[model samples]
Target: MNKLLEVKDLNISFHTFAGEVQAIRGVNFDLYEGETLAIVGESGSGKSVTTKSIMQLLSANSEIKSGEILFNDRDIVKAPEKEMQKIRGKDISMIFQDPMTSLNPTMTIGNQIMEPLLKHRKLNKTEAKHRAIELLNLVGIPKPQLRIKQYPHQFSGGMRQRVVIAIALACAPKVLIADEPTTALDVTIQGQILDLMKDLQKRIETSIIFITHDLGVVANVADRVAVMYGGKIIEVGTVDEIFYNPQHPYTWGLISSMPSLDTTEEELYVIPGTPPDLLHPPKGDAFAPRNPYAMKIDLEEEPPMLKVSDTHYAATWLLHPNAPKVDPPLAVKERWNKFQKQVGSLNGGK
Candidate 1:
């Protein structure tokens, strides 16, 4: 696959009244053409910050300390505002988390979807409206002609999300960034939206950057997964590798914390301790304090990403050649066992 977007040595910070908060620390990753890449992490883990930077959507208080965001051979970080205005919705589109605030309640759905078509494609009103209805229909909205004429309030929550997706896909962007687009929906709606996105990708041939803290959500959707923590990508691998053969301790914690419906346990496991303080970013590994498998070296130096496979890499001292071999927690092993058992049963007990 071709490299569509590449982020190298990306460092981002936010200037606040308290101090300069380091949001992204030397983050690096790649998004290939026609693939879904899921960036998973907690709320403040910089997943959104990194994706926002690709769209140049960071606030005025934020700064790109140093790095390059290469999209189609163009450095987006250095692109002027005028150039970015041309790139925003036409070249790259984003489906934000919340649909309620994302849409203008006053404007009809048709006009909202047509806004991008009018601004980017320079289409006439008739042409734009035609395209808008087509978009609404494409996203599985029923009676596009009548629905487009109605306000956002007239539609259900799921319908409003479909409208958001329609607007995002209106211009046929090369890249689509979905920042936890399913976070607000129920499980069934989430599944429908995921299916819709995968289907749309096939039809449009657009790369997708899916951001979420939910590991279970991306299981069937993502081709590759990047695990973020303390404002950095701690591990990255193919979906199968990350879920079946994780290397990072933090990754193990996340896997163990997944809520299992088959199990009788009602209390979902939580990763203990708070995330690292970025205002005074740690000198050593940021997750050292929280990592049970951490060693003396973890507190003294940050570990570089060690290659586990051609497609898998993780930043942890435990991956060091000289570090101690620590076993993953029993809960994580049990979870993996349950998954394997389920897979085996589905395969006719093979």
Candidate 2:
């Protein structure tokens, strides 16, 4: 697969009354053509901020300290606003979490979807209207012709999101960045949206960067996963590798916290301690305070990312040659074993 987008050593900071908050710290990742990469992390993990930087959508107070975002072999960071305007929707599109906020309340849904086509393709009113209805139908929105003329308020939450997806696909963008796209919908609706996205990807072959805190969602949609913590990508690998043989303590915590179909545990496991403050950043690893298996070196120095395999890398002392080998918690081990058994049973008793 060819590389569609590359983010190299990206760092971002926000100027605040208290001090500068270092949000993204040398984050690096790649998105290949027709592949889905999911960025998973906690609320303040800078997952959203990193992707927003790619689109040049950061607030005035936010600054890119270092990095290059290369799209189609061109550096987007240095691209002028006028050029970015042409690329934003035509080459790359974004779908925000809240469809209500993204769509204009006064404008009809048809007009909203048609705007991009008109601007990018220079289609006439009749042509744009016909394309708008087709887009709605493509996203699995029922009664496309009638729904196109309705206002944003007329659509339900899930339908509104469908509209958002329709508008995103208006120009047949090569890449789409969906930031918590299903957060506002119910579980059934969420599943519907995920299925719709998968179907669209199959037909269009668009590279997707899906940003979410939900591990469950990632399991269903992601080809690869990047676990973020304290404004950095601490671990990255294929979805199965990250789920089955996770190396980072933070990644372990996230997987253990996921509700299992086989486990009937009364209480869900939660990671202890809060994320480190960025204003006065930690001298060593930010996750050391919450890590039960933290070594002395974890508090004294930050561990560099160690390669476990060609496709898997983690920033944790556990993978270091000199560090002592310590297994994950007993509960985590038990959960893994049970999950393995279930998988074995499902795959023709392998």
Candidate 3:
């Protein structure tokens, strides 16, 4: 697949009265054409920051320390405001976490969707309005022509989210970044939203960067997954690689913590300790403190993202040639085995 966006050694920091907090540290990943790349991590893991940095939507105090956000062979990190304006909502678009906050309650839904078309697509009122209605229907909104005249307050939570998606897809953006778009919805609505996005991606052939803390959601939509910890991408691989052949301890913890359908265990697993404070970032592996299999090297030095396969890589001392091999929790192992068996059965033993 062709690479749509490449983020290389990206570093970002936020200035607070306390000090400069390192929000993203040398994070690297690529978004391929027409594929969904899910960035999975706990809060403050820099998943949102990384994506926001790509969009140039970081807060005023945020600083870009280094790295490149290469999109379509152009560096977005250094692009001027005018250039970013042209790119945003046109070439690339983002659906924020909250539909309530993302939409303008004062504006009609139709106008909200049309705003981008007028600004970026240079469509006149009549043309933009027609396209907006088309987008409204495209995102599964009912009576788009009538609903477009309604304010955001008039829509239900699920409907409002659909409106936000319509707005994001207004200009037929090549890349769509969804930052936990379903976090605020209930399970059923969440599933609907995800299904909607997957359907839209297929129809539009848009590359997506899906940011979420839920491993379960990643399974549904992601072709590839990047696991973040302490402002760093600790693991990057295809979804199956991360799920069934995870190499990093952090990855193991994340997978194990997720509820498994086939597991017989009564107790749910949880990773120990909280994420490290980034204001005074740890010198060693940020996840070392919480890692049960942490070796002395984990506490003394940071590990590089070493290759595990052609498409899989992980940052962990455990993957070092000299380190002892430690098995993941029984739950994780069981889940991996189940996934492998399912794959084997699907292939009819090849």
Q: Give the Å shift of residue 42 in candidate 2.
A: 0.5
TM-score of each: 0.96, 0.95, 0.94
249-273 per-residue lDDT for model 3 (tens digits): 8888887777644555665677889
Local error of candidate 1 at residue 45 (angstroms)? 0.5
State model 1's lDDT. Answer: 0.92
Error of 2 at 32 (Å): 0.4
Per-residue lDDT tens digits for candidate 1, residues 1-350, read 99999999999999999999999999999999999999998889999999999999999999999999999998989999999999999989999999999999989999999999999999999999999999999999999999989999999889899999999999999999999999999977987898899999999999999999988777868999999999999999999999888999999999888766576666567788999999999988998898877888888888899999999999988888888888778888777677666546644788
- For residue 109, what is the lDDT in candidate 1? 94
lDDT of 2 by residue, 49-73 (tens): 9999988999999999999999999
- Best candidate per TM-score, number? 1
- Which 10-residue window of candidate 1 scores lowest in summed lDDT? 338-347
Candidate 1 has what TM-score?
0.96
Error of 3 at 82 (Å): 0.6
The order of the candidates by lDDT, greatest first, is 1, 2, 3
- Clashes (backbone N, CA, C under 3 Å), per candidate, total 0, 0, 0
Off by over 4 Å in 2: 261-266, 333-350
